[model samples]
Target: MGKVRGELRSHCPINFGIEIFGDRWTLLVLRDLLLQGKRRFGDFQASEEGISSNILAERLDRLTHYGLVTAERVAGDRRQIRYEPTEAGRALLPVLVEMAYWGARHDPRTAAPKSFALAYEADRAGLLRSVEAGTNPSEG
Candidate 1:
């Protein structure tokens, strides 16, 4: 689990996790970073979910506070900032993958691409490595 900034709701692992990322937008932001390689604020703004600037800002702030992400100004470009996931954030990849798998199995209208499911099942570790390296496995 990622580091908690404030007092946790309880000692239960599930409750601690929920307190950190239970919000609707937090997981989506993580998806963009982990899967889509989105780093810039504008990139997140362009996500299909259409998250507003205010909400995105808040989520990013919270993620940073929890040590899941690191935000830094781009080299030689103080006006532009990039956000990258820390190790704790990358550790959530398995959770997201499992959730996607569950959704694909249970939801008739699931949107997860079949290719991704196949690759995930074929080599889960390789897929995780590719994602952690900021590469889209489907593209490679």
Candidate 2:
């Protein structure tokens, strides 16, 4: 069961955010869902990070419980479920983008581009708008 806001150790917003994504795998699962557009269990397993099956299942369940993702059966396939981000999940785009910027800035070998940080810095709102409209800064 998810820890409700009232049950949290503190009412701090940052603490709430950390409670959702403090683990290593949760945010990566979200990155795949929101940024990489991966939906299947196999798809997430195939990620470069190579998360284990048990951990992925747990994270997906947690995300569903927390209203961050929705799992629906694939058309004509009851066994194959597709996962998608909910409004709450999509709202994490800024966090993802900021992390990308921070990584690109600090890491010499980061795959993230420096120009995107410049782009985001110049028009933070516009970039987020574009991403929400299915045009991501991560795309070529």
Candidate 3:
């Protein structure tokens, strides 16, 4: 792998992409947005890895700025703002799914949940359906 040089903004497309989500927390925040339907600070705080409030706030802001996420106020709850994935963000689903499947397959200690393992075993179409069902509100 080539080393990143002085100014990141001038790097190639790959470097630019990594610059946005190169950190551990950024992808975790994206995972929460996709799998858990977490749209608020409190919800993210309650996730398994227990991200810090300050970090969560910063990630949300960055995600919003990158156009991967959009914030909207909950109807009838002016104080509650929800963060949701945009079309670009939703396009990352396949990448996340592939990563999960690869991890479950290669890592002996992963202990992936039964449903996830089952989905990994199925055909791509079936696996995508399962992922969609899990992500959609009515099924959740």
Best by TM-score: 2
* Tens digits of per-residue lDDT for model 2, 49-133: 9899988988898888889999999999899999999999999988987887888888989887766777788888887787777
Model 3 Cα lDDT, one tens digit per residue, 3-106: 22335775697877687777888888888888667888788889888888888887788778778899888999989889889988877777777877788778
Listing every candidate in turn, what is its Cα RMSD in Å to the true structure after a full C-alpha superposition? 3.5, 2.7, 5.6
- Please rank every candidate by TM-score, starting with the best: 2, 1, 3
Reference-based lDDT, residue 39, model 1: 96
Task: List model 1 lDDT by residue over 1-140, tens digit each.
Answer: 23336788698989977887887799999888887788999999999889999888888988999899999999999999899999999899888877777787778897877777777888988877876676757554
Write down the TM-score for model 3.
Answer: 0.80
TM-score, per-candidate, Cα-based: 0.85, 0.87, 0.80
Superposed Cα deviation of residue 19, candidate 1 (Å): 1.0
Residue 90 CA error for candidate 1 (Å)? 0.9
Ranking by lDDT, best first?
2, 1, 3
Cα lDDT over the full model 1 = 0.84
The models' CA-based lDDT, in order, is: 0.84, 0.84, 0.75
For each predicted model, how many residue pairs clash, with residues at least 3 apart or on different chains? 0, 0, 0
The candidate with the higher TM-score, 1 or 3, is 1
TM-score of model 2 vs. true structure: 0.87
